[model samples]
Target: MDPRLFLADLEAKPAALRNLASILTVGDAWAGLPAPVDRVLLLGMGSSRYAAEMAALRLRAAGLDAVAEYASTDASWPPGPRTLVVAISASGTSQETLDAASGYAGSAPLVALTNVPDSPLARVADLVVPMHGGTEEGGVACRTFQHTLVLLLDLAARLSGEPRDVASLARRAADATEDLLARRDEWLPTVADLLDGRHGVYTLAPAERLSSALQSALMVREGPRRPAAGCETGDWSHVDVYLTRTLDYRALLLPGSRYDRPALDWLRSRAATVVAVGADVAEAAAVVRYPGDDDPYVRLLTETLVAELVAARWWAAAF
Candidate 1:
């Protein structure tokens, strides 16, 4: 596997975040822009879909009615003047996103949130908000994901009618992520040793925050050529519990979810291993922690650094 390109994309995140911060500052006033519509539809696919999910959360928290839909399918909503569709794509070339953006252009104004401003999706969008993660040739979205989260926060600031220091928050996100990256040697090997030769790994997160679990599974599968599954906190009981037979599966648990510890206990008896990141859940067989502040939104960005480290380690070992 050619892992250098993937590693380059992952490593570029800190600078990408800093660049986003500089551009999203209070003075820039992008966040100060009035809400074009009270309802929002965010569209993407793969990890870009995950970015849309996070952006929907931020937008909803700021009191907007927002939903994220897979751009691969045709989506519909009640016709209203205060409705907008935002297409998010890292490459800005996804056929699904382009089609969705085009479909929505004549109805509600289409906004393009993408890394490549000149790409096809961008061309169809009535408004363009550059993702500014730079070019990612890794075939996976890494830094672009981070950039999207920061932009979502900037959007939240704008929609809330109370602009925040988005740049400062981005700096904090960069710092927190940097601290985790600094300890790659320590955390990566530990996770690798536990996961080495495992049949597959399961990733768990709250149902409300499925992006964490989805991205975790994506990293392992894309980086290590490993079979991986992502699950919601409650759904794993009915669906994923069947993996308990051989105890060959490991789990990367994103703690702070609703049913984590109880699920962790159940998984410990069944799961080969469970590693907790950010939250210190004692039930986990191993714990890799990062410094996170009070903002749960920032945790969304920083805590993901642990999964990135694990994926990178697996690449090094396999290659």
Candidate 2:
């Protein structure tokens, strides 16, 4: 992907989000589903799957039976009239998702969330909910990824019986994205330096917002071809903590998890560098804050911009 085009794609995030907000205001995107939705099965790959996983977790917390599966999986829930299968692919041409979704085409209601409404995936869907993320031109999934999360959050609200003003949340997310973009000169340099360790970048977030961590790391690797990884904050101590002692560990911390303290203790003890986003932490070498960060929804929707910008910066430099 072209780095300059990627930066341009990121620059358009606020406007794209505002457009999505307006779309949500007009009508419910999922209104076309069949009568009963007893179970939810979300299928996707890459960023689509990342957003779906977070949405599935929220749905389960709301006491609904929901699961996000890799579209490549050989087996999944059986097709049924009461099942709602959401096939998400920004391009609407992910082969695995198309294959998995085809299984439920007639028996279960298939909903396609895609940027290209007329794509092959939409052809099989009973309902086509456009992402409205606009064209990336950059050949990257930045805008589509954010739009996916926002739309999936809306879906979670609908199924959970929770009346969330998703449009308002999208508006706030736009503001936050604009704030970050406007102030990039203030924090990008410091964050880039802090996270530019020899080993690579590590991203950590709470279970609820783990998608942020995963997507952030993916941006670094996808754009810059860098070595990067993501981990859940609580699970860090058990799985990733050992690397800090032997490597020059640098991390982007999305601070919301209650278990953050334990991971911070290890990082501090090992003298690892950290750049906190959306929330201040004691051990962070730098902290990036913006408007609407206090709201968890806003943080979830906006925090990944830090890594994305950093990725863009590094990628541009290399070329």
Estimated TM-score per prediction?
0.91, 0.99
Residue ranges of candidate 2 with Cα displaced over 4 Å: none
The local distance difference test score of each candidate is 0.76, 0.95
TM-score of 1: 0.91
Error of 1 at 179 (Å): 1.1
- Count of clashes, each model: 0, 0
For model 1, where is the 10-residue window of minimal lDDT? 26-35
Question: Candidate 2: which pairs clash?
Answer: none
What does candidate 2's lDDT look like per residue over 292-317, in tens digits? Answer: 99999999999999999999999999
> What is the overall TM-score of model 2 with all chains considered together?
0.99
What is candidate 1's local distance difference test score?
Answer: 0.76
Model 2 per-residue lDDT at 132:
96
